[model samples]
Target chain A: MTTPSNKLPARAIIREVGLRDGLQSIATILSTAHKHTWIRAAYAAGQREIEVGSFVPARLLPQLADTAELVAYARTFPDLFVSVLVPNLRGAEDAIAANADLMIVPLSASHAHSLANLRKTPEDVVAEVARIRAARDAAGSRILIEGGVGTAFGCTLQGQVEKREVLRLMQALLDAGADRVSMADTVGYADPAMVRDLFEDALRIAGDRFWCGHFHDTRGLGLANVYAALEVGVTRFDACLAGIGGCPHAPGASGNVATEDLAYMLGSMGIQTGIDVQQLLALRAQAAQWLAGETLHGSLWQAGLPKTFTAAAAVAA
Target chain B: MTTPSNKLPARAIIREVGLRDGLQSIATILSTAHKHTWIRAAYAAGQREIEVGSFVPARLLPQLADTAELVAYARTFPDLFVSVLVPNLRGAEDAIAANADLMIVPLSASHAHSLANLRKTPEDVVAEVARIRAARDAAGSRILIEGGVGTAFGCTLQGQVEKREVLRLMQALLDAGADRVSMADTVGYADPAMVRDLFEDALRIAGDRFWCGHFHDTRGLGLANVYAALEVGVTRFDACLAGIGGCPHAPGASGNVATEDLAYMLGSMGIQTGIDVQQLLALRAQAAQWLAGETLHGSLWQAGLPKTFTAAAAVAA
Candidate 1:
């Protein structure tokens, strides 16, 4: 294994995923108006990329029932890179219809997790990716397709997911015509060492096509794992506002890394993310009010930004 | 800058500083009996180094008034490395009298913080260390002296503490007869990149004499900062159980990194801490009950160890 480079990227992207990932796992069903406000506030806080919601059936996930509306609302922002989660070709079709910039297809690398969570084998998901690509191409749409491999580290049900297996699925997704690929520690099983080891290889394999790193803060290693991936030149990450999400299968697990906290970390390191953390914290306060009764996570909300924290723009200047 | 070494040390130390740092700032004043239980539980959970309490006047800090009694109690465990915090020569005398393994003399790198917190300038603290060393030598005590520079990253009261000033203070402490030196981000201002840069320089200057890294999780970068230090080959860190400390001056800042969480991070990285994180969690549960109504911090308590986590001993084996 090579030593981790201390050099961080000059800029990075923190794709806000709270609308889909954070809202889906919670009990509250946020209204389309609330989601529209959330998207507006997030954009105001300088978030360029946002996964607004997922296009699953309303019966299965009523919390995300307004995915189409939210996508249309987010698309109104001229420079916003709007995305949505697509479970299959049908969801991808809806995303395209809503004119989303991208649609993410999640595949679980853990065989048991794939069956339990997605109701399909890993290979079956790859085939579905191929079908979705064909459909997108046939529609002559400009929407990008990102195959995000979850359980890339391990799974609660499967205990350990082999690194080789994760890499193989990522390659298969690319071969199946995925425009981009990303990895997710869906169950929060990833440590910095594991992230460094796997993400290094992923970068070698996919290079610039390795789109993002998604990490859950369940065991509190999310930011550290992001730091590890950052060391290996993975610049984009997925985070939830106030860290609101959890795997239903992993009891008591927390959400992804907090968007405000991640922004603070990157800014403090002189890595530009074009985010205003104070503005993000204000949005988080609004989110807490909307998602009352839910356990909100993150430290920056309490402590505020440090006296030494420089804004990303200031750092760049 | 050099690349960060991915090769973590085979073994590292997590020195528990809860009894001293945690109790001093909180309203809850744990009884001597509770402290005894805490020390016993921590030792049972495989923590060897512990700072039982500080040697300040009881009227000033009634919480840590039982420092001498606690030191005597902790000495019963022949293998335990017991330490205490001392403010000046008088406290060092008390530590030497108590036959403590070591005494940490804290020197603030920020002049404003130094005057406000300790009522002594940085140079004054260095001179005090010299007097303490003389006293220790005169008493022929085997107790070691560690000069810890706090606010080494930056200070809330003084904004930014210069790197040259911090390095100069560290060197001054050593020249004043300190047996070892360490750095602390007293107000939780440190980021991982700052940690890597400063700690790499510290390691170069002090080598093995650089005893520890003390970080506060006030802004959520504590564990990530620890990971950066680990990459730079520093193997010792100071943590509070359940993350039960905060700065009196910085109102919203949280405590040091949580002991159980830090243990979990190290074990996950295949570093042998000799700590059973499950046992540490149980102790944390007890600590929570003992200090009820006080806000505690950390993530591992909510989500237990991951399915993929191997015990440090197993990893070493």
Candidate 2:
């Protein structure tokens, strides 16, 4: 039997996405001042990478209308790599104007979902990536462009998305000039075996350009899927504080893997995440209070860190 | 890097412990009729092994006082391997009287937890297993004895449990006449790496005699820990329906990994669990109703099965 002990990487990155992916789905619109404080707390707690907000039109996602402001505030701290999600070239231009460190262009691999969610086909999104890449080069923007393939595992609308199609789109995005690529279990349809299989191939195709894994805890396999990705050597992950995101179609479903829970899992496994779990938990408590009426999900808040956990074992974030 | 692709077993056993471990910890006392129906549903849904209940004093766990009756009822179904938790020789005698297929004697590896929870040291419990084996032999019963090592990961009262001590006690239990042995993360302190490390050692020590893995979702690593155990070639696991159990010290902590979620994970991976997930969901809904007012946990019930799931791929129970 192959042991996964040697397969796991010593260090991993968790890009906080609560300010973007999380806030857009929920009803409660957090104020910019409150978001600034949240970002400050997150930065203080040892988070180095954060998806500050999305660059969608304010009328579309007013919750993240302050994406430029958040990116600016987050950039005040050195080494805090900031990212913003953009749907089309227009949103990409807004991100470029904001001088964001990176911009993620979401392309749904599922044909139906792509048209429904983004009002375009997968190929259309790929074409837009080429345009966005040209625009970035013309503007001399140093910001990285990431093609995030949503519903890469499976989709609620499309049911089953073929892995080949997902891979093809990823390759197309790379060919269209995306700086990096990643896969997301948009509706939590991914199981560990699927994650391992798809990601193994993804690693072979994209290699170091495979930026991150985004999983929704909608069906409770989020962390398990993360562990699977880790075994396959995909180190970077996207997490939301308090597990704040969810599918609007599936009520009572959870969002991304909870930041604190994921942090604890990595720390316990001796994987250097550089995020202080206690501080992250403190931030989770505050976020929970901020989004009180909205149902929050996670396990570590109630059962704090185990007594066996030693802060000395962890490296400074 | 060694790939975990081939390490996972194609089929695994999930021993339903909700009726025993789950019901005992909660305040609700389910009627014997309800439990009988629950067993019937579980049997129909494809569960072959079940820990009927504990053979403890009625006043202590009036919730499980109908254990003998449950065992008897469960035995009526041919091929249903019914097991019971026995604390001492007296409980073993009762289990023998009930004609149980197996009797598990729990031995906490943590000294403080052993004393506090069972009022016996680990050695004392090992000695009792020997006595229980002797009594079974004297009674001319063919019941299999399993020694379940709880807090094998770490403990709440005592900080860290040494791996050497845990393995030593496991060998001790076998030396004392246990037919099988298993380990449990009693307080949910284990991560996948720790699970893989310890379980690999356990498989080497016990070989085919290694019984099962029991994990609590207290900190949400239960399923991930299960995946790790699977990678180490441990096939059997303990789970509760709706995740009905918890650490009493932790107010809002979840109990065991939900049976349906575990089944889904195994099934999605091309593992043949024999149980129909749809039927299991039906049983979960009914059990949730029977144990109303209790905080239930699990993800599949809220979000129905992924469209990619195919029943033809599964073996019949």
Candidate 3:
């Protein structure tokens, strides 16, 4: 956790979203039993936080239908911050019952993306969050609520998402009683300069309430954009283990920045994340075996650690 | 070229090194005729600087055997800054005879790498630079002599190259009569933090005399490393057109950052590179077709530009 004083965040957290984001787009369907193994292995690999799956109906997304079960399983780990993606209040209720550490409700900033993907306007999603918050309070749930603003940079359905609009939605979500807000480059339209400019303004608006920076490696700027976000003090990121989550909108587009690659970059910069990169790579290999023929992406798996890096330091317990 | 204020360099240059760095590594034997076409198309695609070939012995590197001829062909373009790599005094003589715009002599900073790769110690290479400079002066050649320090970050054979050692070599090159100097992450053992910290000190020492930043994309930190150098106002970078180069020491390691992706990043950041990314992509396709079995690394060609990006701006005439 030895982040240079005030120059960069002392510690950063990489939340694994492979089960939710990675599986949602790919054709792979790991058994629920395998999902539990992933959770346990990830926790043992020094990953304290993981988005096991999304609380969506089996009919909608068969891949993450067992999210509640996965959340319950992940909860057994002492320090693991178990998280689930809940589309609406019904899913949030399930999350609360599972006693998850956090539930992320996603809202698209682009109206066109919102309508096309979520079948609702941006404001509608915001309003749904306010309702979800009320329900959580009524149920006396201690679970944290994170309002994730998707397509914060731009959208495939709608180009040029206005910065003011993204900021407005972010402020509205925080005012609606959410525990924290995060920004996602859902369609991978972000560049480093764009990330720095937007995240600067985002931190100014949300301050400590800004939870995470989620980036896709669609155009290969994923790690570069993450670096830019780090420049402005972002200490949390959402990534997949093998960078397997492709954007369904942009065919052949890549997925989230690979967790192994992200972890290597963070650890190399002397930023502590508590997750062992070596363990992450092993998990990636295990995940790769479970879902054969899937297009897994990442650079470190091929190149391994840099010669200057001490393998022991990145080795997970 | 509209450069930003002193905070960010308004104009940036993507010096094409695909021929020298890219072709030298791959097994593809592009004919002298194909090399001419590449140089012409690259120039027509708004590339103002190009490293045509290396002035090495024909038996050692048959691919770049036609270095002098390629330099002559590239020099036909009005605005093109034709350059070549000179391995020793003999190579320097060939570069001077070809009337190149610039000649780069590479020196490996890691002692083991220096002896293995170049058959010379760091000091030996520095002394050679002085001899090469004397020859260039005696030959009355205006061709700029650039002493390129490779493995400036770390090396595959010898790890943990000290920062002080890299700086000393760079200073020695300048004192030995080299016209300008550049630093290269030859093994891709660099992170953005390392790039920023080292490049900041390097810039402080060399100022604008620092000719270029050359990075390998081996560990996927190439563009991120480029961004870090850009933060310190580095305006020149060396890149392979399709990322066709791979380090020989590290098996499966990637080459210099791809020209097309680097161009896209710079253009999107509002840093002018005078490169049309679409045109670069077309050239990459042409190059790819020629080198069928080779693995070309880059992201933009696969995902394409985001809908928000104006592709027309990236299309060269």
The RMSD of every model to the true structure, in order and in angstroms, is 1.8, 1.4, 3.4
User: Between which residue pairs do clashes occur in model 1?
Assistant: none
**Model 1 per-residue lDDT tens digits across residues B263-293:** 9999988888888899999999999999999
Question: Model 1, which residues run further than 4 Å from truth?
Answer: A1-5, A312-317, B1-5, B312-317
Quote each prediction's TM-score.
0.97, 0.98, 0.96
**What fraction of the correct interface contacts does each predicted structure contain?**
0.72, 0.73, 0.57
DockQ of each: 0.60, 0.66, 0.47
> Each prediction's Cα lDDT score?
0.91, 0.90, 0.86
Show the lowest summed lDDT stretch of 10 residues, model 1 chain A: A308-317
Interface RMSD of 3: 7.9
lDDT string, candidate 2, B1-317, tens digits: 45556467878899999999899889889999999998999888888999999999999899999999999999999899999999999999999999999999999999988888899999999999999999999999999999999998999888799999999999999999999999999888999989989999999999988999999999989989998888878889999999887555433445899999998888888777788889999999998888889989888898878887875545454
The predicted structure with the larger DockQ, 2 or 3, is 2
lDDT by residue for model 3 over A1-317, one digit each (tens)?
11121265557899999989999998878899888888888887788889998888899889888887888788888989988999888899999888999999999899988887788898888898999899999999899999999999998877899999999999999988889999999988898889988888888888888999999988788999998888788989999988988656545556899999998998888777777777888888899899899888888888888878764434423
Q: Lowest-lDDT window of 10 residues in candidate 2 chain B?
A: B245-254
- Candidate 2: stretches off by over 4 Å: A1-5, A249-253, B1-4, B247-254
Q: What is the lDDT of residue A287 in candidate 2?
A: 88
Better of 1 and 2 by lDDT: 1
Candidate 1 - CAPRI tier?
A: medium
